[model samples]
Target: MPTTEITHALLAPGESELIEVAGNRIRIIVANPTLLVCDYSAAPHFPGPPLHVHPGFDETYIVLEGRLEVTVAEERRELAPSAAAYVSGSVPHTFDNPGAERARFLSICSPGGFEDFFRAMATGDREAIVGVSERFGYEAVKTRG
Candidate 1:
């Protein structure tokens, strides 16, 4: 649920809400009406989500450590630390860690509300995840380029 009262939020290290999804540790740093920010670390060569889109919001992936392979439509790029990728909500996209070392990154979603998807994903229930995805306009595409 989106916070009814938007306020400042600060997450120190492990203080955030941490959820393990798809073998990745995702810490939700901030979630409010206007933005949602999460910090996550992906295991080496971890395959990310299938090509997907969240039509309700735009997203940005900012690499904090190691390299993250990001694909937006047909274009793929391996981004190093401090590198970032901005993806429009209508674009089909995905990300993974292609390097041998673990990769850390921040995922920022504007007009926040998608954190519920992560929470639902933490339950490891496919049906629930699908419902939440549908509710949030998050959809995995079969063919996108």
Candidate 2:
């Protein structure tokens, strides 16, 4: 078996690549073939993307500040600072800022490349977004209000 090389990166405060998705500002910390890490900040009462599932990787979130309402499958919960949540592959999940202040969190996705979809979305490349979503086996599910 072959071994994968380890990489190192250091980003100062506010130094990461920033992108806007669905009105949320995402700061990309690191994106490699094996992992994608990002910081997400959203305004108060901001609802994130519709329920979605990743067929290829698991996603984890760490709440850094404020509060977030997270929904996974049939369960919903509110996470505060220093809280964490995990959504496995094929599980439908979504999150939103329910607090009165801005919400911030860090997200990590395993087996990387999802950042491509984010970049495409930020650039408003509809075709690329659709293609990347399909290539990465991501599907959105409708949610009832």
Candidate 3:
């Protein structure tokens, strides 16, 4: 399929989604076989709590707006606008907005398919996330969503 720009309104709106990660509102700005770019909004009212990881794909997060508290492995750091972070495959990572304002960022995942994982989570298809994770060589285990 050709690249598509999917907005947040086009996605299933809620407090939590699988396709977008736990603590953010994700809008797929671009999607194709090679790459997927998502726009994430971490609002102050949103409690960013989900800790998850990717197995096969590496991802880069570029802060477009506010600040965020990012935790990768056991280390935690704060990222400001224009700053970026990278998460390699098999690394456990999570983040939340510590600032009072909304945090916006562009997250690009290489090799694309992780988009489906997020989509499944947003649509309430747990099996799809699990299946996709298994095939991709990583899985997200947590006590809550």
Candidate 4:
């Protein structure tokens, strides 16, 4: 079992960097070979980016506080506190927070590496995500996974 607090040997602090994307503060907590956990905080009306799909790792979103607008393929749902959703790998999905309060959520990715993509976004580069799909064992394909 893991220790009570993630110590120095487990993972370094700088290893988990915070990336700011579109007025949202995204912090990568855990990034490993098979699991990835990221914490995201978005101000009210923070519009998410375009819909994208990953062909390798599936994703799960756990809303810690506030509300979120999530779109899995063609279906859209409003998620609140303690609410969660799953999107299989290679599915087109996106999310946004339109409420007045700060929306906080945890994103989990199986087979890891989502943080690389977010880090690229933090650089404020528009085209960084283009090569992300290929770099992180995921293809930016249009197929539903």
Highest TM-score: which candidate? 2
Tens digit per residue, CA lDDT, model 3, 20-95: 4555678776676667788888877565656677677888899999887787777888899899999986788777
Candidates, ranked, TM-score: 2, 1, 4, 3
All models: lDDT? 0.87, 0.88, 0.75, 0.80
Summarize candidate 2's per-residue lDDT along 67-134 as a digit string, tens digits: 99999999999999999999996989999997789899999999888899989988899999899898
Candidates ranked by lDDT: 2, 1, 4, 3
The sequence of per-residue lDDT tens digits that candidate 1 reaches over residues 8-79 is: 775678688898877788888998878989898998889788898988899999999999999998999999
The parts of candidate 3 lying over 4 Å away from their true place are 1-23, 45-49, 141-145
**lDDT (tens digit, per residue) of candidate 4 on 17-89:** 6888778888888877678888889878987756777777888999999999998889999999999999986
Model 1 pairs whose backbones collide = none
Winner on TM-score between 3 and 4 is 4
Models 1 onward score TM values of 0.89, 0.90, 0.72, 0.78
Query: Candidate 2 regions off by >4 Å?
Result: 1-6
Clashing pairs in 3: 18-118, 18-121, 19-118, 19-119
Task: Using lDDT as the measure, name the better of candidate 1 and candidate 2.
Answer: 2
